[model samples]
Target: IKYLFINHYCTLDNLFDILLYTPQLCRVNVKYLCQLHDIILNEIPIILSNLAHITIEELDLPFDVFEIFIKKMTSKLQVLSIGIISMNFTYLDVNQWEQLISQHIPYLSKFHFEHYEKMPSLSNDHHNLLKQFTTFFWIKQQWFFEIHIDTQLNGVLKKLSIPFIHIGHVLNSSILSSQGIQLVISSVDERDHDILLNDYIKSIIISTNITCLTINSSMISCVLIELLEILHNLDSLTISYSSRLLKLHGCSQQSKHHNLSTTMNITKVNMCYVTKIEQVDFILKFCPHIQYSVQMILNYHH
Candidate 1:
């Protein structure tokens, strides 16, 4: 089987037994239930050991289980998404993880991770755990095929992942390779504005191509505009605001596209609370050539 998706929680032992026979499977997505703690917490070692040699290239699993998988699994992964349960753990080993990535998973590039727990107050140790990722990427920067981070500003978890969070590229991804860089920041909060803004801009403003970008933020409009100005060849952009913060930058006369044109580079844009056509028209100015299928929020005068 080339792809397998399990929408419900299944016992790890039973899943392993099924995988053992499906040697041809290349990707698996199992929506594991947290209630199945026995499978994730207890049987991880055994589950990983049994599937050590499989060619599975992409996966989404609980954080701890995937941690074990990353260190032990022989298959080189390309894309990974992990639901982190806690940043407050005292025993998270960073050095071991660094060594594992450097040695075993050298081909891994794209990653998506977000905290699932309710606790947002990360202590110094939690920040350190997060730092491990920064360190790993920094070390592997020269070898990365391309880098991207897209963070969707969701409340509760003050996390950063988008473009880079939802998507990434390793030199050895099991799926189709992404050829360029991208950065997305959406739904960001003021609490994370200071440090994250400084850090992310400094890190990503390198000499590379950001082919696709999205900025659905108002608090960081100035920062986003400065970032857009720096990019030499941004192919597409999808930006929105709860209000008219960006649209007030005003629409451009130079941006002209046919309503039926289909060759633009921007992906789909989601806009709400838009009460005017000038607002949508102003957003389209970012990538005048973009052609998406979505009917941009049409606030026609009745």
Candidate 2:
């Protein structure tokens, strides 16, 4: 097969077993790549010379295991996109990645890396993490990295990419179990702002049970309008306060016409950095069912 896609959970061994048969695979997309137990490998010559594109939605293995897999399975990888949900500090090793890419995927043109870790536990400062990603090799590859810290739920999100934007929920067990999963969606370039919401919603795994959402983008007002229309089950909403408070009314013209207050069953709204009372009032207009609010007015100077 020239193309292979696995949506179900597969161990590293099982993945290699499958690849053993498909030696001509040019593209592979795995939704969940994991290793539950000790993986014993049989020394077999596995060469996927045509494997140029690889995308792993969830990487649940150690970086060392991944390094071995990449070296053995791929040869001409042009695009590599992977997301990690682990506390392993080794995954953040910049030198390791530089060496791996240099030795294995020498002709790599694009790389998308996403790392999610529980905050307070992850003592590494975002600035230091950013500095680690801004090495000479990364600069040469033109892969800029951006770090986003979500303080409300104590989670840190860091993304490094060539020119791709990734949207996913922060990997938090406590928050996720309580149905308060938070998704941070942002575009790498401002030009893709128009289709950001639409593209993000489509990319995410369908789950209507998500009750909490935290938006970290500057276009929160308009994005909130889109969320209200789509995520009907969302109850708790959090957004950073921006200077474009008046844009709420202008952006919600559709909400004004349609009885949005009746359908928007959001019970809690958190404008954590509210600069004025008018912003709260405007939000309340859309979510009349909001029983709780955590708006803290601050002297937000531009």
Candidate 2 lDDT at 145 equals 46
Q: Stretches of candidate 1 above 4 Å error?
A: 33-65, 70-73, 85-93, 116-119, 136-185, 188-215, 219-242, 246-302
Model 2 segments more than 4 A misplaced: 125-127, 150-302
Instruction: Report the number of the highest-lDDT candidate.
Output: 2
Angstrom error of the Cα, residue 121, model 2: value is: 2.6
Q: By TM-score, who's the top model here?
A: 2
In order, what is each prediction's RMSD in angstroms? Answer: 10.4, 16.6
lDDT of 2 at 260: 71
For 1-302, candidate 1 gives per-residue lDDT tens digits of 66777777655555666655665656667666232454433343222322222222223344455555455345655555444344324323557555656686666565443343322343344434433443444334432223333233344444653222322333442211133444556555544445335544444444444555655565434444445555555555555555334534323323322321233445444565567667666455455454455445544434
lDDT of 2 at 131: 46
Distance (Å) between predicted and true CA of 196, model 1?
A: 12
